[model samples]
Target: MLRTLLKSVSELSTKIDKLIFLCQRSAMGVIDRRTEEMDSDAIHFPLRTHEELRSLEAALDNKKYRDHFVARLRNLMCDDTRKSAKACLQYILSPELANIYTLHGTRSKFGISKYKFYSTVQSALCSHFRSASCPEKEILHAMATASQAFLHDARNKVHKRGWRSKERLASQALSDVTNIINDTSTST
Candidate 1:
């Protein structure tokens, strides 16, 4: 019991530390696109697909990808002269889009809540990128599909079989109404 509490505290502390570092980098001018070179060694591999994400996750599981992704994200986030990081985050986190190159920092790494929904999304992205050459639209489609699936699963649990039967009955009734309207129109 004590161990779990300790682990939670440690994780929370680490997250806070990372957030602090991000803020510090933002304050410093290290993130300015104008002042920074695009081809700098401080950057890490871009994460645009699930495969890349998986690689990052693999690297993360081995404790190798954290520093690199964090540095890159921090640098990008710190870019005060441009909207690169903000735009990237917005696109990456968008439900309608998959910001493949930036969303999942590394493979095994989970976000704040360690939610499986996001992990499943990362895996789907990895699979999509691995199978296709041009994946921009594909990734977005996958995200939308995955999101719907996740939401459906969550909603399904709350919905009883009785409710589904009721829904079917309601649909049949609506269809009958439509049929009657069509018959009336045809006769007129």
Candidate 2:
């Protein structure tokens, strides 16, 4: 009777383990769907000029723009780097991950470090693409370069537009003061 009870417990344990695994996978699927929705709303790159911004807006309005852009990026990558870079881009652009890093100001949350994140991305890439030639260092470098470029372009655009608007406001105020002075002197 004890041996039969032990066998039943083992089977139950295995079933519970399978249920937990399925739950985790379903949770990940939900997160991925949410991330895709957020990605649809957010622009990943900085627009340097008004024209560029308008162009991007137009492109986004078209539903196929994302696929076209991804295809173009993939075409730019060499064969060995393509799969890894694509996977890295997907991971980097995940809205949930971005929010965690941006809002928390740290990458150590949920016991995840940079290395672990990279490894996860690499493993996913290998499983999905059946290729592992691309190194984690290269993926890191690509992410860094893209992030820096986006920030630099965004800053430059903001500064230029900010100064232009400030100068225009100041000039308007000065003209208003001069007009007031001129009218008072003439009336007096």
Candidate 3:
């Protein structure tokens, strides 16, 4: 009788283990689904320049991510030894990247050929300021200015325009965005 009781207990334990496994799997599924919903939320209701500008403004106003991005830009921009911001845009003219676009099926773009050379520290810093027409380097470069004009334009939306080079700005915009933007990373 004792042996019979032990066997029954063993069976019960096995069933309990299976139940625990199922519960854990179900919980994981719920977590994954929740994560997907949050990510999709960002997409279905994407953060436009106006919104990001607002969010960034709030963050800067509150002295949040501003500290990180501000310090990074200060370091990157002060290094004149590095290539100019416009020079970085040369990738926009590349045959491989230019001919192909990964923008949403419909959106305006920066006319790459139309970009003008930036003159002073202020202009270069503000070239892509509020327009959000320029590349990441330009964005980071703009932060380097710490110039009132840069912040003023961004705050006032002085150069509001379609976000061009979606391929560079939005990750979902392009399949090869990493290579497209960091194409110059290998050189330096």
Candidate 4:
């Protein structure tokens, strides 16, 4: 019975990790959209002093324009990074996690209780974080990289001493959901 429980936990962890990946990708899409908008909104320089400008333009080349555009592009990128990081921070702070916790009410009746399930999830998520070779690492890295802008503020609040990653919290929620579904399947 415990072996089955562990298997279910493993599968739940995988599915929840996938959901985290989807959310991170959606956040990146937002960043990419901002980058495109910045590119399209580039300012056009007015013709500066016709005669002197002609002589100056011949000597100036595109360097000045290129440098200004690059600076603007970097600013846009920074803005996008900040926005995405804020969204991710909000996600981590949301009270929706309580709803996730409620799914495991029945699991308490079994030996597979909430704390144990949470521990399993925490272990899996930390393992994935430590091993960059994991399939979920790319998604985790994208999330961490985008969230760097907010880390100093969010690092303390996202997780308690028990779990370190959003992935772990999400996985615990999924394990509860899977247990509920399996209970239904057995009943039918």
lDDT agreement with native, every candidate: 0.43, 0.45, 0.36, 0.39
lDDT of 2 at 59: 44
Runs off by more than 4 Å, candidate 4:
1-152, 161-166, 186-188
Candidate 2 RMSD to the correct structure: 15.1
The digit string of per-residue lDDT tens for model 1 on 49-144 reads 454333333334422334443444444432221233233343334321231122233464323124332443344344434345635565555544
The ten-residue window of minimal lDDT in model 3 covers 37-46
Please provide, for model 2 over 18-80, each residue's C-alpha lDDT reduced to its tens digit, 9 standing for 90 to 100.
997556534433213443321333334322333333333344344455444444444434444
Among the numbered candidates, top TM-score falls to 2
- For model 3, residues 1-188, the per-residue Cα lDDT tens digits are 99999999999999999997656534433213443221111211122333332332333332333344344333434333123332232211222232222211125432222222112223434443435455556555443332223223332332344334445457665657767678878777
lDDT (Cα, tens digit) per residue for candidate 4, span 1-188? 99999999999999999997656534433123443222212222221223322222222234444344334333323223335333433332232222222222444321112332222222333333445454455534444544343333433444443434567779989999999999999999
166 Cα displacement, candidate 3 (Å): 6.4
| lDDT of candidate model 4 versus the reference | 0.39
- How many residue pairs clash (N, CA or C atoms closer than 3 angstroms) in each of the candidate models, in the order given? 13, 0, 0, 0
| TM-score computed on alpha carbons, candidate 4 | 0.20
Ranking of all candidate structures by their lDDT, best first: 2, 1, 4, 3
